[model samples]
Target: MNVETTVADSSLLRQRAFVAFWLARTCSSFGFQMFSVAVSWQIYSLTNSALALGMIGLMQFLPSVLLALPAGHLADQFDRRRIVICAQLIEWGALLALVLLTLFSWTDKTALWGLVFVLAVAKALEGPAMTSMLPSLVPPAILARATAANAVGGEAAVIVGPTLGGFLYVAGPDVVYSVSAAFYLLSLVLIGRIRYTRPQQPRLPASLSTLFAGIHFIRARKDVLGVISLDLFAVLLGGATALLPIFAKDILHTGPWGLGMLRGAPSIGALLVGLWLSRNKLEKNVGMIMFGSVAGFGVATLIFALSSQLWLSLLALAALGGFDMVSMVIRGSLVQLDTPDDMRGRVNAVNAIFINTSNQLGEFESGVLAAFMGAVPAAVLGGVGTLVVVGVWMVLFPHLRRRQKLENEAAQE
Candidate 1:
């Protein structure tokens, strides 16, 4: 069989809508990461409570659970561009509020909680709309390339944002918040320039029935469900990010600069892998690659847990990031390729819920476990748990392993 090439057509790369959307997304992500670091640092300084830091994750997750279904329905019913613009505006407003609270010297714990909760609401509104707009900006044939490019852009932000935020924090937290607000406003303007023909909406009831449609769609596709479950469990167990502050201060014996490197290392690894995969098609068995990469991630986490040397731990994180990127690109491409265009919004909404929930749940679990046992034990247990998930998924979803064979056979037909 001939190899399926993955390089995107040069002309599509020059398309105005795709370029505009990409720029807007990349800029927005940079600002978002900066704010994330600033908020976590501020809350920890003010309250000195791990549970409070965990609450920040919970605030974001709860809104995604409650609003994602409705937000998906709105994406289907309204103009996606407008939905994105409005969400950006809300984000800008939240940032501005944060800035004012800082300016007025209202830096109390209650005020910080209010700021986090408002930001959570904004993220819940934005997440589904942003994801559902992807297919509309580029054709289906180059969707994988687009996904890779998108990941690269986000990872770039991750590289720059945290490093910048850490430096700015030495000046003041207010500087970080103000800079983030400015970026959000700029992103809003950039998004307004994209001009794509919005698809016509399908007439559907505005009821619980329509929301359940997304669940039904996922239930029928064994391959899609398998990939999602793999990601959900792997991330839930292997995520040690919520404990980074503890590691940075206690184990690494470094300051905020070290924290920035720890946060940015994985994204750097992910960026490198994304760039490489964008050029080469996945002609091999993708299922094996996905599971193998995830297992590799678990091993990397174990290395990170045991290492005393800071540089060695950074190397381990970089490897984990690269493996995680491979899993993400494979699963994301499968989801987009399998779903019908009309159902993309709801399907993506379901994906958002699962992915975001796993992140927060992992954070909460890590925090609780760290408080009870210790950071080292919590990190070690999380890695062990990920290995168990990999074993369970391999036995439960044999079809995922057969996915490449199925694709090759279809191409021959």
Candidate 2:
């Protein structure tokens, strides 16, 4: 086992395809983050309406909700790499258009929204293809570590992208858009360099059943269902981070600087932990560890909710982020490792919907609950609810709770 692990660890470091994929994924993240900052600023500058800003999110979210399953089906039936490339190509074209329009002073709020929607549509199609490709790039033994490494790239991009965009925007919106487009071009080129053995899958006809195969696949696998749903409910209940602004302004009596630091705490924590996990392995009692990490996340959320001190709140938020990272890495690795290659795209699509919707809805849930009660109580309730969910899920999915490895079912077959 030690020899095997040594080989796996080395394989991860030397895997060329995975390396390209990681670089491509990181470039894509940087572009997306830069584009987000540019578009938001441009939209608000044009309309100066908060409603218009809200509509941007609505437009972006609508496509994922509507197209994710179809996108999944497409991933299953075609070259996953090509699908990702095509989606990013579309995004790159949109960014180019944005650059031209902004340069000419021809872009309006409506045009911006339309462009944002197009980008979102491409993202919806790209997400599942990108996610489902990871398991094929490296040995299953290192998938969790690879996932952590992937996340570290994203975390680094998130920390840097917006600030970079903001600085470039000083030159103008067009400059930011131009730089973002360049990143997408790099991502496309890197993706083109990736090589993988595509499994021979039967050409499944398009039908309701085919489109929804991922749902059925997940439902039949109790372990997969448990992991997916546990994340959904736990995140849905533990979205107290959404109340940061409220806490900063009303409770903590601080300025935007404080809010910025508060907002950044979680990402910093996640990034540090991700770096560690990338070098280390989670080789034993993974299921229990995942559950415990989630419970720890809840405990951190509860502490953050109750804390009146800024330092303590930041610490709690950071802890929650670290815990959440552990859970995310475990859950993602397990699902991908256990799934068949033919069904991976569709399954990941369903998983994407769960992840995306849970985050958006979790924030929405916290805001609504905060409106009814108060930020503190709402956050406290969310933390407690997350803990309750962890307990319930452990009871409900005994097999998942006792699971010990991240072995690839397809490889064994």
Candidate 3:
């Protein structure tokens, strides 16, 4: 270990703008997680249909596919901070509407889905601007740490938000919505206080070229393309979490509580690893480390697919999460550092689309595969497929595989 580089204090906490951004992100992420849980429960109660629950996901995903590119263009052409603020305001209003609708018993499944769709639209607009703003908050030297820290906040929210929402739902769905709205309001205040200076650049006219510029730019940079596509395929193929309900019931022979634990295990593992990465930098052979992490993820998933015991399966899932965190930190830092400041928004917008597509489609892919084969075989196939992807990516993007050091890549450019 390099002692000089291993200093746990990366000083990110001392940067006021970065701190504000971090806290604001954490608050909003918590709100979204809690909101998702409450909305699902309420929708199920109202409609009493599993298809209704799936519809909610479709409602949330459609905007990412449809709006992300245009939203990215807006991020590059306009004030990123202002865009984020406006997006959060829209989310806050939607949450407030949910509270009122639930309080008055005016809420129906359709109304719930519509409001959720509105929130998703706001998120689609906010993601690119918010992501592109991170490079400005901290020095380039510690961006990997900053990205890891950001993941820590998000993972923490994922682990706790649903349980908190579930507990608050015992009071009423309105109570949960009210708390979630409060969290969003807090996020709005924090983000509003952040200071940023948008560079002077000629505003380009809206056109097919301007809208698709992010995609074009990404295609020109092999390293960035490799990192982004690697993540897309890794999660796309390694989506074993989608089959947790199946594992909890028939395979693991456990109940709802067991399923909850199984669901939370990966987040717990990711959180722990994220915390570690936030403190320590990957100072050498970062590309190789990233590839290794993905490979480790595949191995963990395979272990999970084969395990019948709940304990062993949980361990495998946790390992999978930890390896994923390592790769996520590397991939996120690489993409941000390699992209120029002027095009960061558009590039990140493209990145967001890939992420959203992978997540939504990964679940769909898992379900279809599981239906054709048994859950174990499908999950086993996913795990093995992830390994194959890593091998092929290494061969396809040789420069990315041989790269060393996170910051050095940007310097060489």
> Clashes per prediction?
0, 0, 0
Reference-based TM-score of each model: 0.85, 0.96, 0.95
Where in model 3 is the C-alpha error above 4 Å?
1-14, 408-413
Q: After superposition, how far is residue 74 of candidate 1 from its true place, in Å?
A: 1.3
The residue pairs in collision within model 3 are none
Q: Cα RMSD (Å) between model 2 and the true structure?
A: 3.3
Best-matching candidate per TM-score: 2
lDDT of 1 by residue, 1-413 (tens): 33333244434544677888888898899889999989889989988999989788777667889988888777777777788899888888888888888778888777777777777787777776787777777766667777888899999988889779989989888899999988888889888987756568667877987886777888888777888888998888887877888988999898988887887789889999999877767776888888888988998888888777789889989999999998898889888777766777788888888998898788889899989999988999998899888888888887786567213133211
Off by over 4 Å in 1: 1-14, 40-55, 104-112, 169-174, 243-260, 367-381, 405-413
- Check candidate 2 and list the clashing pairs: none
Candidate 3's error at 136, in angstroms?
0.6
By TM-score, is 1 or 3 better? 3
Sort every candidate by TM-score, greatest first.
2, 3, 1
The C-alpha lDDT values of all candidates are: 0.82, 0.92, 0.92
Better of 1 and 2 by TM-score: 2
| TM-score computed on alpha carbons, candidate 3 | 0.95
